[model samples]
Target: MSRFFSSRYANAEPYKPGEQPKGQTVVLKLNTNENPFPPSPRAIAAAAEAAGRVNIYNDHMCRDLKAAASEYFGLPAENIMFGNGSDENLDFAIRAFADDGFPLIFPDITYSFYETLAGLHSLPQVVVPLAEDFSLRLEDYRGLKGMVLIANPNAPTGLARSRAEMEAFIAEDPERLVLVDEAYVDFGNESCVPLVSKYDNLIVTMTFSKSRSMAGARLGISFACKELIDDMEIIRNSGNPYNVNSMTSAMGAAILQDDEYTRKNCAEICRVRGWFSGELRALGFNVLDSRTNFVLARTDKIGGKELYEALKARGILIRHFNQERIKDYNRISIGTEEQMKLLLENIKEVLK
Candidate 1:
């Protein structure tokens, strides 16, 4: 460790992202939950146009992007906030809303980044366990008083609660701040974004990475009441007012305006998810009923790590966590039908 390193983060365990393998390393890359399709043509054009104007500083407020997002989300511009990605918005929320007195609370097994963010901010945290079937028990969060962050259509498990259920939970405590991470909402899960207008204490964040096919662009959108957004904006401005670059802002606005493209891609991914889950189940794997573009599955024939290793050896990639509870399961992101068929063929060969 460097002598100049801060002692505050000496014990911090940073979030580990999925491995990014070179194209030649794996024929099918399905570890990270990125959209398999290309982005809308309009978004690509907008980005190209913006790239020409990069000499000028980006709009600190991201006014044009926010206006497009506002129209798309049916909210006032003041109620929306943009960040480098949803992770930044989540970090900002933790900084702006949580503390020693006001701790952060979320499911013990979901997203995993919430814990990282809590650690990074040096904030107290309360971990609530999910139900046996991996469904979130909202009742467990009723008595806790703090900022709550939930990853809707939660990672790995892909299980999700409906918007009504979320609203009911939010109504249970008006004083508590609830942050909903809807990064995978477009893939057949209901979003809590609409509730932001009705609930002042609610914050909803979405990324253009998944459904919008702009993971490379690094744009994330957040919606809340004006006051809550103002709070997050304060935290945002304190760090980097022009967090989103000019090209990204332009691309994000164009994609939002091209809602049909996003919708079509999400619908196709949902279809692929359903078919892939059925195929996995047919092959003696226990696959979760997922609402997102990924599935968590395990088979009695092989250990999770063994399966992951075997697949990687055969030029395929999937995510396997070393965490105790879910160590035996693997997360596979949905790709195109042809890619999935190739994956299935490889899995069958590996099983044999």
Candidate 2:
């Protein structure tokens, strides 16, 4: 511990991201859930063009990006906000809406960042348990007074609640703030962005990292009512008005304009997910039906850590969590069909 370290963060545990092996080791990286496809050509060109103008300060408000996002999502520019990534938007929401006295509520098995965010802000938090089948029990969250955060088509498990179910929950209490993260929605799940207009307390955030294949661009969009957007903007401007850089803003807007490319890539990922899930099930793995570009599965033939190590040794990287409830499970991000086939072959050998 450094003497200069802040006392406020002394008890905080930082979030551990998926490993990115350095130095071109030629590993098939499937642990981080990145899009297997490349970014849209139009987005790439836009980024290249924007790169030439780095000497000038970027438009801190990201007006161009907001306009494109507004037209694509059918929301007004005033209702749209940009962040470095969806992580920043979620962090802004936690700061803007949550109070120290009122806890932030989320599923125990969902995105681990919620706990990290709560801890970083020194706010109280409550984790509602998922049901035995790993489905989110909406009934359990009913009547809770704290701010709510949910990852749609939730990570790890990838189980999702319908937009209608989400609406019902948001409408149940107009006073409580409800933040829905749709980072994985473009794959197959229905988005709650449209409901932002109907519910003043609702916020929906999306990232270009997953569906748009702009993980390096670090772009995220948020939709909410005008008032909420205004409040969040205060926190955003105070923290980092230029949160999104010039290249990323341009790249994100170009990606929105090239909707055809995004749609095609998402469809391909979905198709691969279906085929790969079936293959895993055939191999006696209990694979959860995933709506995201990844699957969580486990098998009796090998332990989760053992399987992860075996695959890593074979140059195929997947994710394994040490959490008690899901220690036996491994999450494999959907890659190309050929990648999945190679992974399957390695798994069969390991099992044998």
Candidate 3:
């Protein structure tokens, strides 16, 4: 152990990412919410071509990628910004708005990373309880005098708030900064990016990990008013000028332009999600109504911990939270149709 370790990191609890077990026999990985599809062909080519440019310093401004994304969203370049990944942008947004003086607010059962972000920054947090069915009540944040963060079509639960509900909330109180994390939005929900042009306090962040099938590339984008974008830029610039490296920036430009490929992949995943939900229900499991790329399911007789291990021993991996509230349920990512069929088949044996 080093005696000169930084005091700030002495008690830090870093976010625990889903396991990526290297060198082990291949398993059907459904633990992380990654797309079970290849990236756009153009993105593959762009990454290949970008390999030759690694020696040179990437454009710290990431202008071309920013312009491409701006064109895709029909927004101005000044209204857009990019980050190494959506998680990085999430952390940046938190630092930009919330601090020790003003606490951040989000659902208690939401993304586990939110809590880790609180500890990482030495900031206090207010965790509001979700409904019995894991739905967020925007009314909880209404009139609250602090920054608000929400994952739209939120993680694990895969539920979304109605657009009309959000609009009314914004109209009623437009004081505190609100950021919507749209990591899973491309699956089957409306993004709040369009709301940014009208509401100066609204910021929407999105990732290419799920829909674009670029989890390894790590690209994130956000749209907001020029003022809000400027604030985010200040944090990013002072932190990491070249957050989006050359390969990721090039691939991001290519993937954003491949709208047709993205749509086809998303439609395929949604179909699998619907079928998967019905199959689990037929097996006596209660599946949550999901609009994103995953389903939350609970067995009538099997425990989540037991089922998780049973599936893992059979070389299939799915997410299971050990918290008391959700310990009975498993958050399963919608794999490819064939992979899901295997999950259905193996689960029968595991339960028996």
Q: What are the runs in model 1 whose C-alpha is more than 4 Å off? A: 22-24
TM for every model, in the order presented, reads 0.98, 0.98, 0.97
* Model 2 CA deviation exceeding 4 Å by range: none
The TM-score, computed over Cα atoms with residue i paired to residue i, of candidate 1 is 0.98
Off by over 4 Å in 3: none
* Residue-wise C-alpha lDDT for candidate 3, range 1-352, written one tens digit per residue: 4989777765468888877867666569998999999999999999889889999999988888988988899888988999888888888888898877778888877888888888888777888889998998888776677677888888878999866767676667778778888899988888787788899988889999999999999998888899988998999999889889999999999988888999999999999999999999999999989989999999878999899988888778888998878899999999899999999998999888
Model 3 local distance difference test score: 0.87
Error of 1 at 236 (Å): 0.7
Cα lDDT for residue 50, candidate 1: 98
Q: Write one digit per residue (lDDT tens) for candidate 1, span 280-331.
A: 9999999998999999999999999999999999878999999888999999
- Listed per model in order, the count of residue pairs whose N, CA or C atoms clash below 3 Å is 0, 0, 0
Local accuracy by lDDT, each model: 0.92, 0.91, 0.87
Stretch of 10 with least lDDT, candidate 1? 19-28
Candidate 2's TM-score reads 0.98
Report how far off residue 315 is in candidate 3 (Å).
1.1
